[model samples]
Target: MVTYNTMIHGFCKKGDLYTARRVLDRMKDSKDCLPSTVTYTTLIDGYCKKGELEEAMKCMSEMNKQGCLPGLFTYNALIRGSFNKGDIKNAQKVFDEMTCKRDIITYNTMIHGFCNNGDNYAQKVFDEMTCKRDIITYNTMIHGFCKNGDNYAQKVFDEMTCNRNMITYNTMIHGLVKKGDLDTARRFGLNEG
Candidate 1:
């Protein structure tokens, strides 16, 4: 199973999805070793990265048909793939259909996707997060708000009392500069320095 997975990973890494699928088919034929969650995830991620969302969805369906429950990573890959393809509807559908408990990565992915697409739902996802958010979560929101040319970035920045990494400061400063608030940007840079 390890060997087969490695071969699949190699093929997928090389963008040889055709060979990757063939390897997966061969692995499925083996009685002792079946495709695991990792195997399907690798293939799905590869397809997603290649912008081959249809193939990724097909692989997801095959994984479900094989009785292998999709894990968090699997769902994340699908959501990201859908979003990357600018298929927000499908991305939301995948997110809504997720059965497993969502982790930070899932929420973060959605937030990033929504923000990148200039969608206002980034805040909705941020507000819906019940789990503890890390720096990435806050950073994503701040950056999104700034990108959208809203004052929400300042609101979010003011809310963060700690865990403010360089990214947080830089993003805030950049946003301020972009908004023609050079004074605020200079103050932030000085404080960071």
Candidate 2:
């Protein structure tokens, strides 16, 4: 069963959905083993990454019908695919439909999506997250703000209590430079010394 799952994952990662589906079909034929949630997730993620959202959604529905509970990782992939296509409505729909507790990755995907869409939704998600946020969370906001040329990235930097790393510093510097805030960038760059 594990081997079957691995084969599915390999085909999916290779973006050969047909072969992946064939492997899944073979799995379904065997009475000795049942496909797991991880199997469906790999297929959904592959389809989403390939921009085949319809197929992904179908797999998601099938996954649920097969008694496989789609978890945060699967939900995140769907949200990301929606965001990749600038479809916030669908993204939010999937987000709202999440039956499991969301983690930082889920919120980060939302923030990154909203940021890419030029909305302030990230702030709301950032505030509402009940889980412990890591540097990736902070970096997402900072990078988003910097990409949008907004000085608000600095405020997010200020909010980080600890775990600041080179990525954080580089994002801030790059953002400041992108926004033409060279003087402020200089001040920040000096801090890195």
Candidate 3:
């Protein structure tokens, strides 16, 4: 199984999905080893990174048919793939399907996706997240709001009294500078320094 997975990973890494699929088929036919969730997830991630979403979805279906339930990484890959393809509808569908199983990564992915597309749904996802927000989650929201020219970035920044990383400081400063508030940016920078 490890050998088969390594072969699949190698082919997928090379973007030779044809060979990857062939390896998967060979794994399916192997009597001693079967494809695991990791195997399917790797192939699915490869397809997603290549923007071959149809093939990724097919791999997902095959994973399910094989009685291997998709895990958090699997769902995250699908959501990111949909977002990368600018298929917001499909991204939302996948997100909605995750329902009760969403972690901070899922919410962060959705936030980043919506923000990258200049969509306002980032806030909705941010507000809807029930899980504990990591620094990545906060940074993503701050960056998104800043990108959208929304004041919510400052609000989020101010809320992070304890967990502010360099990224948080830089993003807030950059946003202020971009908004033509150089005085505020300078002051914020000086205070942080």
Candidate 4:
């Protein structure tokens, strides 16, 4: 059963949500094994990745109807989907719904959503996080700002409390290169060293 679910996830990753849904339908009817949260979340993620939020929400509904609770991973996928759809409001709703289970990833996804939306709202979310901010949070904000042509990514990078990694440096460097700011990128690398 887990193998079948894994197959579904693989199908979803390939953007073949149709086959994934078919596999899921079969999994739902299986008498030997009930569908697990991981199973539903995987489908949701696949649909979300494909920017099929309607289908993603349907999967969320089905997951709930089947008595499986959506985890932070599930919500993160949904939030990301909403962001892709340019629906930060929906992402916030999902974030708010996650009162207890909101983790660093949750906040990071929200921050990324806001950054992608070009709203600079990630700052508010970042400032309000109860969970310890991690490197992904910093990287996402930096990437988002850089991606959106916001000049404040440097501030975000400077303010990061979490340990920086290659991805973080690479994202900043990528941003600087994209902005034709090689000198700053080199300077950033120098400052880090």
Candidate 5:
């Protein structure tokens, strides 16, 4: 059962949600095995990655009904599923329900979701997170700003003076170039390290 769960996880990680589902079905058919939380988690993750939020929620419900305890990963997957579907309300509900224990990756996933939407609300999420923000978090918002021509994104770049990564420099240069600010782009390109 453990190996089966791991196989499903591997398939999901490789973005082969279809194969993951097939493995899950095989697990379900096996009389000798009982699906664990790991099994449900793998299936939920696979569904989330494939943007099948309804199916992912079903997996969550079934996991509970089967008396399998959900861990952080299960909740994380559901949160991401909701976020991916642009259901921020549901995502917030899931987030609010999580106990005090938190992971940085959960916040990062939410940041990415909001950024991908090109909505200004992403910045609010960033502002509210007390967890240490990493390069990916900054980059996601920066890219979103550049994509949407939101000046607020530029303000974030100005605010990030501590961890100036190469991607950060490159994104700024790309943003400037997009706006026909060749001089600024050249200056930013020189800052790339």
Candidate 6:
């Protein structure tokens, strides 16, 4: 069964949805081997990566129908898929559901999902996350703001100065240079001195 899982994962990684489904179907046919949550997750993740939200959502629903309780990771994958599809309402729904069974990974995934989707209200998610925001959270938000070309991204960079990590500094410096604000970058560099 583990071999089947690996095969499913390999197919998923290669984005061979057809072959992945075939493997999944074969697993279902075996009385001794039922597809586990991990197997389903790998398939859903592949669908999400391919921007096939409909397929992913259908798989999630089927997982539920098969009496498989999704773990936080499964929910996170769905939330990410919804976010990637720009379906903020569905993403928020999954996020709210995850809050009832809070986990650090779940929070981080939702935050990164919103940040990656470039949703303005991603800041609300950042503010409301109960877990400690790791460096990745800050970097994700910074990248999102930079991609959005928001002037207030400077304010975010200013706020990040309190943290003063290398990646934070690098992001701000790059952002400033991109905006042709070498003076501000030089001032920040001096401040770090």
Q: Candidate 5's error at 48, in angstroms? A: 2.1
lDDT of 1 by residue, 88-165 (tens): 988999999999999989999999999999999989999999788889999999999988889999888878745789
* Residue runs of model 6 more than 4 Å from their true location after superposition: 99-105, 143-163, 174-182, 191-193
Rank the models by lDDT, top first: 1, 3, 2, 4, 5, 6
lDDT (C-alpha, whole model) for all candidates: 0.92, 0.87, 0.89, 0.85, 0.81, 0.77
What is the C-alpha lDDT profile of model 4 across 39-104, one tens digit per residue?
999999998888899899899999999999888789999998998988778888888887356787
**Residues 1-193, candidate 6, lDDT per residue (tens digit)?**
7899899889888889989989998888886798888888888888988899889888888887877777877887888788778888888887776524756666666767766677777788777777776767777677667667666667766565346577776776677777888897787677651
Clashes of each: 0, 0, 0, 0, 0, 0
- RMSD values, in order shown: 1.9, 2.2, 2.0, 3.6, 3.6, 3.2
Alpha-carbon deviation at 146 in model 4, angstroms: 6.7
Q: What is the TM-score of each candidate against the true structure?
A: 0.92, 0.87, 0.90, 0.76, 0.76, 0.78
Count of clashes in candidate 5: 0
Give the C-alpha miss distance for residue 119 in model 1, angstroms: 0.5
Q: Distance (Å) between predicted and true CA of 57, model 2? A: 0.6
lDDT of 3 at 187: 83
Better of 1 and 4 by lDDT: 1
Backbone clash pairs for candidate 2 read none
Which residue segments of model 4 deviate by more than 4 Å? 142-158, 163-193
Number of the predicted model whose TM-score against the real structure is largest? 1
Question: For residue 98, what is the lDDT in candidate 2?
Answer: 97
**Candidate 2 — number of clashing residue pairs?**
0
